[model samples]
Target: MPTVPASRVPRRRTPAAAVVLSVAVFLGTVLSGCAYEYSADHWDDESTSAAPPPSTDAALPQDPHLNEPVTGEELDDWVDAVLPDAAGQVFQTGFGTLEADEERKETTAQLPKGTYALTLACRSTRRVSFSIENGEDELVDLSLRCGTSRVNVVQLAADASLSIKVDANAPANFAYRVSRI
Candidate 1:
């Protein structure tokens, strides 16, 4: 019998390694054929209503900590700066820190029949979720990425008791304002 040299033997890949390699190749092929688009500054495209036209007046100051998460006083200041000025009558405005343990905060405001803009901004370790409802009917529900701002326009055919809920997976600071447009 002749003994074969170790260098002449073919290496055998483990089942786990083969599965991983197959998954990588499959994902690469599938992803390469799909086009993914993202906008860091705009709200989600599936929002129920379109955002109002940008104000042509002097633009507000840009977010100073656009690329990083912020907490404490810095988050409060960021929220204040990013909130849009009341173009018409102001219905509600609030700013506060959402503690990590608390997870969520809810508030309600009575708004008269009119068109209004709901602006929300947050600085957090993770994306924060927002749900806005007029009485029992949900108006807007979306999760905003950290360090971004969103403005949603909502119409009230009749007077409504508007409720806004904010939820964060971790500690965060947030601000929201509802004002007639």
Candidate 2:
């Protein structure tokens, strides 16, 4: 059979095939764009220039009985009742209380060589920052929102010790307690 020359052959165009190819290309482009947009919006981009917002649930819940601002007298009474023994007293000595207009306070405690769980409760009506430092290292650094509490576990060597620093910005006299787990 004689072959038709390229210039002499008719170019047949199928409309259905063209429609199907066009639809496929359109769908591919749209889906790709949508997927890229979704990932860009939801993915955690570390390179973002803006600072990441803090977590809303970062604050811990406080005990019902000790979730209010306390006067010095009330704080003393509460401490005596809640921590009634030598062991409690030993832990309580590490806590700091902030009266109205007080600038700042720091308390230190020497933990024996062992693993211990530490719990901090803040009964304040205003925002405050509580940080626990083990020697030169920071162990627990958290901004205690109003009426928030926190708990952490710390392991200490034979000579390790910790300091509790409280910075208050509220007018209400606040009482904070640190106890061993």
TM-score, one value per model:
0.58, 0.47
Quick one: best TM-score, which candidate? 1
Per-residue lDDT of candidate 1, residues 1-181 (tens digit): 9998777778999999999999999999998899866676467677756687877756677655563556677766676688857778887887777766455656656678889999988777678888988878999998998677899999999988887888777777778888899
Off by more than 4 A, model 1: 1-75
* Candidate 2 C-alpha RMSD relative to the actual structure: 16.9
- Local distance difference test values of all predictions, in order: 0.79, 0.61
lDDT of 2 by residue, 81-102 (tens): 4433433334544444676656
User: In model 2, how large is the Cα lDDT of residue 107?
Assistant: 54
lDDT of 1: 0.79
